[model samples]
Target: MLIGVLLVISWLILLIRYPTKALPISMAALAGLALVASWVLWEENRDARYLAHLELRLSYDPQQCPGDRPLAVRLKNGSDAALLELRWEVAAYRPGNATNLAQRLYESPRYSGPGELLPGASWNDCLPLPDLRSGYRPSTLEFRAERLQGQFIR
Candidate 1:
């Protein structure tokens, strides 16, 4: 559908440029449309491949780890296939606090490893949490899992 529209527009431009020429307009239209259609197909295939390669599941033991102790996070592969180069982070936040205190414990970006996870497999890592102010409590911990962009291919 998009290819047909682009081909029509391309032919209109060609007609405007060579009004007096008796050249084959259909050939020009087909060539232009083929190039655009090929590009669109290639892009769609690449995106599908990328989505299929992503298969990381993240969870925690307590859901909300205490600020006074080390935090444990579990990373699992939810897909039937294995995932390569899995990386994750555990972000602990104090409830209703406007400031970002998790940075004080774990660095801005934490490194896991270059390992493979089979179907229904998981890995656990313990990260120390930053001490809170007197009487302060944490609301929740957020875990994010993903393949370091462009670091590995499935």
Candidate 2:
């Protein structure tokens, strides 16, 4: 930040002293600034960009485990990377209810499965549901990926 302020000050001084000479220098600095801004933006949104290539589907079987109905999830990797770890937070909601039945709701626990998903591959597993009130049941489950880690495959 200090360096940027100093550069701006020097550039302004040059512009006041030699207007014609400062024109080319100002143009070069503007181009460099644009390049740096673009790189920084890409770095900040890298995770979201890669996550766009992933898809998730949810299915639930109420008869699978008595009071606790584990969710059957299907994750498809559409990117050119191998996924190392993946986890999601689930929200359980009953029909006509405007709120979640999960015990923690916003602070609910995350569920994960064995992850080694390669490009163009799919993984299927049953993830245990978050803690809910005993004997409480939800008609639907919502999943949102909270942890996604992957590497580009060469």
Cα displacement (Å) at residue 113, model 2: 3.8
Consecutive 10-residue window with the lowest summed lDDT within model 1: 145-154
15-118, model 2: which lDDT tens digit per residue? 99998998988899899999999998876476566667988776665565444546777788887767666665666666666566667666655676455778
C-alpha positional error of residue 119 in candidate 1 after TM-score superposition, expressed in Å: 1.5
Per-model TM-score, in order, reads: 0.40, 0.55
Residue pairs clashing in model 2 are none
Model 1 misses residue 112 by how many Å?
Answer: 2.0
Candidate 2 ranges with C-alpha deviation above 4 Å: 1-40, 62-69, 95-98, 105-109, 133-135, 140-154
Task: Give the alpha carbon lDDT tens digit for every residue of 40-131 in model 1.
Answer: 99866754554355544333444455543345555555555555664444344444555544443433446464377665666765554444
Model 1 C-alpha RMSD vs. true structure (Å) is 8.6
- True-structure RMSD for candidate 2: 5.1
Q: After superposition, which runs of candidate 1 have C-alpha atoms over 4 Å from their true positions?
A: 1-69, 95-100, 104-109, 130-154
